[model samples]
Target: MKNMVEIRWHGRGGQGAKTAALLFADSAMSSGKFIQAFPEYGPERMGAPVQSFDRLSDEPITLHCGITSPDIVVILDPTLMATVDTTAGVKDDGVIIINTALSPAQIRKEMGIKGKKIFTIDASGISKSTLGREIPNTPMLGALIKVSKLLDIEKVLDDTKKKLEKKFRTKPELIEGNLKAIKRAYEEVKGE
Candidate 1:
């Protein structure tokens, strides 16, 4: 993640794919890194397929385009791996982080993928247990950091906690839940 690390996120509408990218960027920015976080919207609707992109680097990013070749592809919605070609433009040595209850071995076999690395996490489970809902964005953010080492985990937690405090001001309880979600996911993420 030193010089332009590209990432692509796959998830369904309203599932926090866009937020994950932004949170990643914001955390990187807090650590003095340059980042771009934006989504590719297409006929958007709740539960519809969605994709977001992120680019983090030590230097300023000049290119302004969707990520065609990502170093890491994170899938928050396991179902998208069925209908969408999630790995289409990933680099040969790319790492894929999928939010699934299944293990990496099972996922790799099910997806018929080879060569590239596949990382799996029960993000939905973590979020549901910690946040009282099935939102996997924050948890997935933790997984992304664990898998890619793109940003400092402490910085991400610090920045994200501050951001969450502002967003969920009236619901402070949710803040702790989200923080727990991130930490749990980071520790629980399994790679292969």
Candidate 2:
């Protein structure tokens, strides 16, 4: 039982950023915690940038406002690094997970981030290598779970699998591959 934690996600549309947010919230709620998950949309197209949010708490959630200061930020698209302020409103102690090949030093320098934990993972690389595609949301979610240590990893996987099964009901092969992608990415993330 910890204090509330808020997470913001940055990605392009159709990248599963929203799905990742929902999956995290659903997993938290299933653990009997209060949770909120939603997305902020614009005129964004499939490849256009977007943002999603999640709030998890041990107590009942009464606030309906968007996250102003997230405890964790997950960047699902490396290209968003130049377009979006992914670090906006993050707390000093917050942790940021980015789907990039850059090291912490490079990320800190490039993103102009200071005084927070920066976790960099080549999620796209993991996804392409393991799942044979460019879909990176699940892999980035794996890295988030690893870096933030906010929820139970096994629970995250279980819940993600269950959710994906229903969402991809007509595509069992995708479901299986996504499950494996999550597992592999989760195991691959490196943290200090």
Candidate 3:
């Protein structure tokens, strides 16, 4: 697991956290990398806090337990920061991508975070304008990919398009909107 990258996602239920992890795993697998994507939650209801995890590596991943320490953290809802320790267990040099309009410096000050790289993006706004909804998961994926540099953006878009098509075939607009959201977030994310 020399090149392994663990990612933890924090978001509320019904906001596509699980879906984003799955899509990320699928995209990595499509690029010939080993990946594991799973969610950790119990009896959850809509708007309840939830967590999802992803492990990507160039070699086989044998561990089958929870991720206590992650190399990257993606926060799909800035509100979760009020209750969840969004930076919990992240490595000292880990990258954090948060869905918010605030600058990374502001988030760092508010959260009292240090050392780790922080990226902020208006994922909700991007999703609302592109997908007609406020689901920030897909846009967060873009931010993660941009920050992690673990996979090619084009390849991810292609793989994600294929996966999304299976379910949104009838609604081409929905599929396109999701793609647009991802690309927009990728470009608009700010880091500090």
Candidate 4:
């Protein structure tokens, strides 16, 4: 990984963008890295577009503001790409990971962005099959880690399972589904 990596996530209010961001940060921290995870809320309502930011570095983060230019962008809600410019301040060669069934070529053309590295995954499909829900944030986290190669997958999974166990002590299926969704997405993400 680079000295520092900034990730921006785009998703609906109800989706797990905030949770994914925090989990990524926490998991990465377990690997002995400095991290910051925060959410930017809009209207504080469900289904409303929202953004979450993460800063991961080998050194302590000195900045405490929004991430304008991200090294990586993860889109759990592809519909947000139509309304929000996910690449606003992103580097021209930055990697973009989107949860969509569409091909990377199709998204590139639709967004009128060419040459930037974009990856697409059927995270919604994976989530439906594994999580029994349409939420794709956990899966997107898998794709993010796969493409960025910042945090080790096993470490993230360990942290995730520990966290989920606290929230779902009696529900083993829910935790398993999340683990399945994440691992499936990690292996299935396609890049261009």
Q: Extract clashing residue pairs from model 4.
A: none
lDDT of 2: 0.83
Q: Pick the candidate with the highest lDDT.
A: 3
What is the C-alpha RMSD, rounded to one decimal, of candidate 1?
1.2
Runs in model 1 deviating more than 4 A are: none
TM-score to true structure, per model = 0.97, 0.91, 0.97, 0.96
Q: For model 1, state the Cα shift of residue 164 in Å.
A: 0.9
Error of 1 at 104 (Å): 0.4
TM-score (C-alpha) between model 2 and the true structure: 0.91
Q: Per-residue lDDT of 104-184 in model 1, one digit per residue for the tens?
A: 999999999977899999999999899899999999999988888877888888888999999999999899999999999
User: What's model 3's TM-score?
Assistant: 0.97
> In candidate 4, what are the lDDT values of residues 51-159, reduced to their tens digit?
9999999998988878998989999888888898878888888989989999899899988886679999999999999978898989888898899999899989988
Q: Which digits, one per residue and each the tens of the lDDT, describe model 3 over residues 56-141?
A: 99999999999999999999988899898889988999989999999999999998888999999999999999999898989999
Q: In angstroms, what RMSD does candidate 2 have relative to the true structure? A: 1.9
TM-score for candidate 4, residues paired by index: 0.96
Stronger candidate by TM-score (2 vs 4): 4
Go through the candidates in order and give the C-alpha RMSD of each one to the true structure: 1.2, 1.9, 0.9, 1.4
Task: Evaluate candidate 4 by giving its C-alpha RMSD to the native, one decimal.
Answer: 1.4
Candidate 4 Cα outliers beyond 4 Å, as residue runs: none
State each model's CA lDDT, in order: 0.91, 0.83, 0.92, 0.90
- Order the numbered candidates by TM-score, best leading: 3, 1, 4, 2
